[model samples]
Every structure is written in structure tokens, then in C-alpha cells.
Target: MTQVKKHEAKLSRAVESIQPSGIRRFFDMASSMENIISLGVGEPDFTTPWSVREASIHSLESGRTSYTANAGLIELREAISDYMEERFDVSYRPEDEVIVTVGASEGIDIALRSVVDPGDDVLIVEPCFVSYAPLVSMAGGQPIPVPTFMKDDFQVTLETLQEKITPKTKAIMLSFPNNPTGGVMGREDLEKLRDFIIEHDLVVLSDEIYAELSYDQEHVSTAAIDGLKERTILISGFSKSFAMTGWRVGYVCAPAAYAAAMLKIHQYAMMCASTMAQYAALEALTNGRQEMEEMITSYRQRRNFFVKSLREAGLSCHTPGGAFYAFPSIKASGLSSEQFAEQLLLEQHVAVVPGHVFGEGGEGHIRCSYAASMAQLEEAVDRIAVFMNTIKKEG
Candidate 1:
């Protein structure tokens, strides 16, 4: 018998079938290049507020290193409950309705896994955060894409929602103050989705991680809507508003049944969020309000300035009302989104993510983060203008 050649162990089909993140490719490439200004990552540039940092350090100094409850420390949960009620008029019992997670990212994953069964279709609003579809797939559910148009400011309409619903459609996922596009759904728009969800007996997973980053208007929570509280699982965290990205703290609020189900998964897989991060998050909720306000004010100014700069450079970009990114159409540059981004990075050393990575509706656009400093934003725009003019001239 011929000797069998050895090979590496096979990976799971579920893991292998999914494509690698499109954002990471450019981000990694930019990292290796000197003087490359990256607009690819969607993270706040601000340091975590000093008060919050001090709280975490103090916790470590006082020996708070051990895990808390699987649902997280009761104190932190109570703070989250009160904060939500005060800010958004949404109520939750800290004991049973809320669970702390590693981050809003984990909260989303568990929420989807808890509610979605095999063969069920999860309707995802795109171009959304890239994780939504992949997480739905990993949960043994079908990932159904629901595209929103740039012409409509990327808001999800009842018509668009209705057209995509199938008998298998079980739940809907949404993120606003959305990533990449920075589109925010107005209260009227969410009311439309609310009616549709109730009529169809569907559940909702609303990711409000960027809730505090809204520029033009106050952020609205779907759970506050009449008849929506029982059906919505709201996910948010300290990452965006408090600039606590590495702190990895987030919370999920759901009805008792759903919360219990998610907690089951959390107890086994996660056990608890970081104890120090929880203390830090407590500090953020209690005393970091003024710091958050100042940061939002700065982001608003950057949004206005950078958007004006893009339009002046001849890129047709919608003025985003929230989030740190601007999705500008690059169709007029006579290049695909990928081409525009790749060539710009190679030539201009200003890195941005191509829009197609966001999903089907993202073609012909690129997502540029305004999270960089004013000086960097100014230089990036200048380089982008030069690149655009070159592309136009060549065309």
C-alpha cells in the first residue's frame, strides 16, 4: 500500500465558507507602509476618559481582578438600567433583563444565537457593520440582505422591509448611527419598522453601539417605542461614546425569556466581562458625561468640516448625521470602489475602505473615517483631491 501523505486537519465548513474581512486587508497593508494615514478602521481616536481609566486602575489596585456574576456585577447592571431609563425612556429590570458581555460585538452574537434557529432567515440592513451577516450565518440561520438606497439617505423603509420578508424570515438586525454609511433612522422611519415587525410576528436585534455619537439629532432607541420593548434586544457599550474600545464592555437588554437564554450561553462561553472594565464603565456612566459631550462636539465639527471638504473635492457624499464615517460615491472617478481605494493607497498613502466590503449595496462608494485629527483630515483630503483629478484626467 502506498504511504498516505499527511495533511493539516480540516476546518469546519461554517468557518471556511465565510470570506475574510475586507476591511482588514487594506488595514494590514496600510500598517506595513510608512507614513500611511489609515481611514480604514472604525474606532474613535480619543483616549479613554481619565476618570474612567483611574477607576479601572483603582479597581486593579484594590484586587478586583476576579470575575463577577455571569450576568455581570449587579451594580453595573443597575447603572445600565437607570442610564437607559433616564436617557431613552427604556426600562429594564437589572436582575433578569440585562447581561453584560465582552463587548457589544459579543452581545450581538449571543442575541442572534439565542433567538435564531436553523433554517430561519435573519434580515440584515446593509450596508451595515460587516459582522451582522457573518454572525447570523454562524448561528445556523440564513443571512438575508436588505439593501437601503443612497438616494434615500440609506434609511430602511417599510416597503424595503416588506419586500424582503419570507415565511422563513424570523428576525431583523439593525445598526444606526450605522458603520460605513453613518445613516441614522428617524423616529418616523423606526415606527414604520415597528409596525412591520409586529404584523409579521418577528423579533428585533438593534445594535445601538454608536447611539451616543449622533451629530445632527438625538439618538432614538427602538425599545422605547410602544409595543417594541418586549420584542427588541438592545445592544450598546462604552466603546464609542466613552472611547473605551479596548475596555471591551457592553450590555444587552431583552425580555426575561430571551435574556435568560443569552445568559445561558454567556455563563458557559464567557463567564463574565472583565471586572476592571465593569468598574471603569461604571465611572464612565456616572462621571464621564461632560467628557462625552466634548468628544461628540468635536466629532460634529469634524463631520461638518470633512464632509464639506469631500464635496469640495468633487466627491458626492451625503452629509452623515451621525457616526465617524462618510460614505462618498466614487462612481464619477471612473473606477470601482476597490480600484479607487487601492490606487489611492498606493499613490497617495491615504488608506480608506472600499464600500463593497460592506455588502451588495456598497459598490461605487468608499468609507472615509473623519475620526483622525483636523490636520490629518486636511492632508488626506488634499491627497484624495489630487488622486481624483488624476483619475478624471486619465478617464
Candidate 2:
């Protein structure tokens, strides 16, 4: 009469507190239907560039297949070091300051793990990449979310950061050219944050995966600010820039002590990323700059087209300064983000991610990826306009 599930009883309370992801519910629905033009995923629509792929194939052809050092191959790490210096004016020693990670995802996980012990509070900017909190929680930290609103261009405020800080806070996780909202924090903005970090004596996890996609201004590294280098973990990768998502290569740059400690975690948990992929990423750093430039240019064109189209469709579109997403309010549509996305998919055959997938603060907003072709974006705009006008007329 009492057959307990094999794993149910032993499951920790920490594991149970996590919920199924909000972003996935919309995805599951969007996927099963045909004629759905998905502007949901943030991935580049392009394939990985030719040169990088060649490097991977070359590695395999030469039988360079084996486990790499847990921190990764030294050659690839050196390439990354040089690339960061040349591109962002950020410098780090290859031997101590960097660790090659599986993706920015792993960099995020290991970075949070390094500083957050049980009950340490992590401050996260709201409407961010959804994974940050769950990763923090899994690593035994609590996330303290600071909400940023549309009126403010969704930028985190110095005042808000000051208000949220407490004695228990360990770190603040930042994502610029951010997910969902597509907001960016320029140099002046990051300087304010750096000053706050020094005053509060806090750690910072800077997720700059979308750094390459900034349209209006240059991507600034938090570590580039003078005093913040020791305290900031810079997370970036080859995914967005070089169309290398499936390659699963990313890295983190921090001080030597942090790198060494994270290497132990990486060794035990992941061992290393794919060796061939690391070789490909090495090629990306050394040779794929032109490809990265071209994609960023295309995204800028797409960003301009889609923002205007979204406004023409009657949604209040905030021009995302970077990244391929436009986060527009669906408040006038009389639908919550989840409802709006479902109806858009069901009626107009367009797929967009509901903004609440990022957090509660995103309830009335929707994230549309403009990485699709021009034709699809036009059709999506037309469909959305009709849907809104019909709803208005009905009311």
C-alpha cells in the first residue's frame, strides 16, 4: 500500500522550491503549431561562419580528439585573452584570469557558486535572462530582484541598487544588451554601478553575452572600470557574435584566485567543453572578427525596421539599443503577457516570448526577436496590427 517513488522522498526542499520555467510554457505551445513564425528565440538565424567551422573540422581531421585541461586548452585561452584586449580594451592573463566554460550558462553557474554560500543574497536586475535566479538558488543563494520600469528605459538605477543592498547581500548579477528587454547600460551607467559596488563591498556577475549586438554605443566591460576588476566576473562567449550557440563555448575572466577556484568546480562538474568546439572558438577569436561585424550590422538594420513596425502596429515599442529583441508593452491589448503571446500564436501564427518569462515585473510586456527575415517581420507586423484593431473594435 505504501510504495513511495524511488526518488521522491529523498528530494531536497531546495530542489522542490524551483518551478517549471515560465518561458517554456509558451515555447511548448508555439512548437506544436504549424505556420507559426517564431520571433521568440534570441539565437542568430545565421549558421556558424565558414572559418570557425573549418577549424573544428580541421581539429577532427588531424585526430586532435581528447580531453583538454579542465580550464581548457591553453591556445584557445590565449586567443581569448588577445581578442578581449583588442576588442574591448580589457586585459587578463591567460594563465590565471580566464577559464573556458561550456557556455555563458556554465560561466554564470560557476561564477555565482564561487561567491554565494548558503543564504547569501544575490541582487538581480529584473526582466533579465531567466536562468540567473535559479542558478543562484541552486548554488544556495537567495536572489533579491531590483525592478526597472519602461519609463526608465529599463535601466537599473543607482538609487534602486542602494535601496536594495543589505548586510547579507553577496553579489549583483547584471546583463546588458539584456535578454527580453534588450536594454543596455553604457559606460556612465556602469560607472555608477561600480562605485556602488565599492561602497557596498559587493561582488558583481556581469553577463555580457549580448555585448556584440549593441547598436547605439560600444559594449563596455564592467571589469574595465578601475576598481571593479577584482570584483566583477565577465561572462561572454562565441554564441551571439559568431552564430555559435550549438558550439557551447563561453568563458569567464576574473582575478586569478577566482579562476583557480572555478577551475576546480569545472573539473568536477563539467571537466571541459567540447575540444573541437574550443578549437573552433579559438578560430573565432583570432579570425572571425569580420563575421561578427557583419552580423551586428544586420541586427542593427533589423532592429530599426522592427521597432518602427511595432510602433505602427500600435504597441508601445521601446527601441532596444542592442540585441535583436524589442520589448513592447501589451497593456492596451487587455492581455497579460502569457495570454497575449498565446493569442498571437493561435490567431496570427506569430510566436513571441511572453515577457513575464523574465520575471513578474515583465507582466504587461512581450519580447519579439527581430532576427527573422524581413518578409516574416512584415507579415508579423501586419498580423499584430489586425489583431489589435480587432480587439479595439470589439471593445
Candidate 3:
């Protein structure tokens, strides 16, 4: 008698092929060690504003503990619509063009799934958020990296974008006031991209999660560009800007058709964003501006101090224009990005993410978040300086 064969369960190829987030891996490693000063994650260090938290508490006390509409709370959608228009001059019909998401992350996932078909190519500006390429792959699209450089202020150029475009290219994902590098695109930089995107007929998935944190210049929405609004899927949330990371509230604004497509997916996968969270988000939009602005001011000060400190510590760093990160080149240390980060963490108890994990154009550099307190930033830099000196002595 033949023995019965044992069945082995298998994950879908899509899920199986994806790697865990590099940012989380380092953060976890650092968490296990004592006295580790982690600059790995890109979360704000501030607590959620009092009014926003109070709104959520009130909702809970009022027994409003239920799921919202699949498209989210109409009140929150209207608030998001107003906030977008007033702040960025981009308007969307709240009724059908805005969908609140579990997070900006979910908005990105649904947006990619809504537009991408198998084998389609999505151009991602490199040294960007770690999730973009993986999300594209999960959506059955090919993620093609378009490298941006520090010399170019990490802004994608028409020429660079053209080099990566193919007939199969379906969309381009952009994040201004970018993560990791903290590079921001000015109007001129975006205008150069506009003609190229129009020529290629590409959908634009513009991740503006860090828009409100921009310094030196105003954050320009890609949808605010003259001809790009119709094709741009704007994804942002209260997490970064309002220090509401734990609140898990974000939203996507797009053309009615695109919004509907994403909403259908959101309906099946996630019935709605949390009811309490939506109330919190509404309060955030209504009255959280002053506190948000104060946080932005603090981040700008941290950026200046951290960038200066990194440079004085002997790393060549491009002063980031937005976000609370400084990507400093570690090439002079005769070490790869991973090596430098590892040695720095092990020796000095300071944890930063290695740049190469952020994809092309990230090698030989390290991403240090300045979202910690000033005292922590000061101590981290001193430790970094000591680490750099040890490398010099060893060399």
C-alpha cells in the first residue's frame, strides 16, 4: 500500500516573494539591546494632541463604537477635502473622491491594486520609502527604480525618468518631503516632471505623508500641478503630521473613478476605518493645526541641528529640506552602509538604518532620524563622532 502523501501549505507567490521591512528589522534589533539610541523608525516623537485624543475619547464614551461607511465618515472626508484645498490648493469632491484609510499605508496598497495590472512597470523614485517597491510587486507590477542623487537634491529629473520608462510603464510613485533622504521637490522640479508624465500617460501615486513637515519651502501637491490633478492619487494621513501614528488614520484623494475602485477594494478588505479614529481625525483637521505647526517647527530645528552635528562629526550630509531624517554619506569610513550602521550600533549603542535598504542610490550612506529629543540628538551625535574616530584609528 502506498503511503498517503503529506500536504504542505504554501503562501501565494506574491506574499512569499516579499521581504519584511528593513526599517523594522533594525528597530527590533535595537529594541532588544540596552541603552540603544534608535534613529531607525520615521515616527514622530510627539504625543497625539490633546484635542484629537479627547475627541476620540468622547466618541468612545458616546458609544460610537462601530465601523464607519466603507468610504469613511462623511464629516472626516469633508474635513480632509477642506484641509487639502486650503493648504495645498487641491480640491476634491468629498462625496466620492476621498476615502479614509486604515493608514496611509493602506491607501497606498489599495491605490496600487486599483491601477496596476500584472507585468505593468511602476517607476519609483529611489532612496525613497521602503514600502513602495514591495507594494508594487504585491500588486503584480514590476517596480522600476529611477535613481535620484544628493547633488540633484534627490529630485527626479525628466531625463532620469525617461531612461526608465517603457511601453509597459503604468504609473510613477513619488514622495516629496521624502523619507530617509528628506529631499523635497520645488515647483520647477515638479514642472519638469509634469511634461514627461503627460508624454508617458502615467498615473501618479504621490505620497505626501510628510508634506506638512516641509521646511525652507511650501509643500507643493503633485495634483496641484496644472495638468496632473486628474491622474494623481494623493495619499496622506494624520500619522506624521499630527503625531497620530497610533490612531491609524489616513486618507486617499483621487479622481472619482480611481477613488471608487480603491473604495471597492477597501470595502472587501477593510469595511471602514475605525469610527473613533475618524472622529479623532476630524478633530485633528478641525483644530490640530497650531500644535502640528509647532511640531513642524521643532522638526526644522532638529533637522538643522542634526545635519550640522552629522557634518561636524565628519559625515558629509546634505541638509534635508523636510522630514526629520538626515542621510549622511558613510563612504569616507571605508565601510558599506550596513557595516557602518552595525558597527555604530554595536560600539556606540546608537542605531540608525543603513541607506542601501532604501534601494538604489542609497548605498554608502546611513539614515538617521532626528525625531528624538534634543538631548538624545546631542548624545547620539557625540557617540557617532566617537565611532567615526574609532574607524579613523582602525584605518
RMSD (Cα, Å) for all candidates, in order, is: 1.3, 1.7, 1.1
For candidate 3, which ten residues in a row score worst on lDDT?
Answer: 21-30
Candidate 1 achieves a global lDDT of: 0.92
lDDT string for model 3 (52-94, tens) is: 9999999999999987889999999999999999999999999
Ranking by TM-score: 3, 1, 2
C-alpha local distance difference test of each model: 0.92, 0.90, 0.93
- What's the TM for model 2? 0.97
Q: Is candidate 2 or candidate 3 better by lDDT?
A: 3
**Residue 395 in model 2: lDDT:** 79
Greater-lDDT candidate between 1 and 3: 3
Q: In candidate 3, which residue ranges exceed 4 Å CA deviation?
A: 1-4
TM-score of 1: 0.98
Q: By TM-score, is 1 or 2 better? A: 1
Off by over 4 Å in 1: 1-7
